[model samples]
Target: MNIRFDGKRALVTGAGKGIGRDVVKKLVECGAETIALSRTQSDLDSLKQECPSIIPVLCDLADSESISTALKDCGPIDLLVNNAAIAICESFFDANTADFDKTFDINVKATIVVSQIVAKGMIERKAGGSIVNVSSQASLRGLKNHLIYAASKAAVDSVTRTMSLELGPHNIRTNAVNPTVTNTAMAKVGWSDPVKVKAMTSLIPLGRFAEVSEVVSVILFLLSDFSSMVSGSCVPIDGGCVAS
Candidate 1:
């Protein structure tokens, strides 16, 4: 299918690296005017070099005020991707309140904040829009040492559902993409151990983790008009891990 976003404007959080970066690139390639948001200015600079037309908004998701300020002049966006997240991986028994707070601050709270801001604009315009929340397979199934991370994503999925229910009347669709261990820099480090990789892949029927493009493809679908009827759904790009 040939999906194009010729005149659409998109805002992607955490667009400096990993899945977020790939999503930005894909949107640009598909003819969308994209806004890239990241906390790291250097990373955004590098991304600007790669995609010169992308608008960079440097906002730390942990701070509510910063989010407000960064988006003050962002204009109206047709698509919103809440992809910024931080995982403080620790066993449930070993996790601390600080880590839990930080994890939820970015993963859950910021997502709601950004979506609300963008959705309000869409509503006012009476044009409607799409929102894709980047969640994880951990939200669906328990994983070792991912207690807080899993909880945050679970909350994201909940927000996606509620947002879909409330916003559907206005024709704004909301959905979540839950990916497995994607082959990004962070995942490379977290799943670097040979034994751990083997054990994890063994559970997935496809016998491997996801590629950055694979996840990006799903996100693009959710944001595009092709999915006009799909909302409040958590689509898993887990290679059958969640199925098993």
Candidate 2:
């Protein structure tokens, strides 16, 4: 029952900040060799400074070529946490088509691409691996102005299920962690405007957002042997939002 990932290798996307950053830190603490990927070199450097055990990789997940190259460069991994995502706060109709494309490309396509690359290695080696995708409550329930974001996450949920079936024989478990509004840098955008923040706070049953570490803790459980039988599942970390 001791959930330890000692000697395992992990790769976490968008790990330069927010929940992804916490995920990487937790993995390192759990004795896993973690490679943190992000687009910002400075953020990657900061993560390296904070967790010297974590190797930082600079790559934009939205860029397919960059993602393919980076994962290949990193060689193989036992855990892949697809935690990078983007959202467009504008109304569905008002949001530019380009924004929608960008959101899906990163939230869905990139995840698919990276999983393929990493899973291939895991399969070939006959090594059991785990993939924890970062989904959202939006994928389970609808939200205003969540058109593109919701669609992308919904796709991720579907991919998780499909991958479980396809990769099960290879012993690769694919699952997702669905979190409600969290107090990360991503959540503060637009909502940082006091009025917007107040509006959002009113919607949650808990009347508050989650701390990044809280989400990371669940992610670590899923990544470790603690969740050995879990696959194709969407575990919610929402604060009473789904309950209500």
Candidate 3:
């Protein structure tokens, strides 16, 4: 079966690289008029240079004002992927107020801001929309030095459920994709240790890390009409890691 979004519109955050970049490209391929939001001008430039059809909005996730200004005039979105986040590694012993504040400000607050604005548009249009929040397997089960990141994602999961309950009446759907340590640029930083990687992957039933495409595929399904009945669900894109 072929899935298409020939006339739909989509907005993706953290569309600079990795999962977000792939999602933007795939949406364009599937015929959605896609908007790519990134804090980095260079990443946006390269993405635009490559796709040529994406609407690029440069706004820092940490700055709510900038995000508001950037999206104030954007046409109503049919799908939204809240993929922008920062992972600050801090164990329980060393967790600080600064790291926690910064983590929640972007991961939790930014997701809420974007979803609220787009949801209002959807409600007014009465056309409905799908929201896919990029949560993490870390939120389901803890790991070493993931205190702030896990807390923020867990908060996002709550946001997703609340959005589903409130927005479902308007035909809007809200869900999240919780992925394990994927082989992305973000993974290269803390996951470079083979010993750590081995320990984590062993827990997964599939015995391997997640891939960028794997996560994006699930996000697309959730964003599309194919998942018309799926809402308030935290779908794991892990290699069955969460279940194990």
Computed on alpha carbons, the lDDT of every model, listed in order, comes to: 0.94, 0.87, 0.93
lDDT of 3: 0.93
Q: What TM-score, computed on C-alpha atoms, does each candidate reach? A: 0.98, 0.94, 0.98
User: Sorted by lDDT, highest first, which candidate order results?
Assistant: 1, 3, 2
Candidate 1 lDDT by residue in tens digits, 18-134? 999999999999999999999999999999999999999999999976887899899999999999998777888999999999999999999999998999999999989999999
Per-residue alpha-carbon lDDT of candidate 3 for residues 50-144, written as tens digits (9 for 90 to 100): 99999999999898877778999889899999999988887898999999889998999999999989999999999999999999998899788
Worst 10 residues of 2 by lDDT: 188-197
**Candidate 3 global TM-score:** 0.98
- TM-score of the candidate numbered 1? 0.98
What CA root-mean-square deviation does each model show from the true structure? Answer: 0.7, 1.6, 0.7
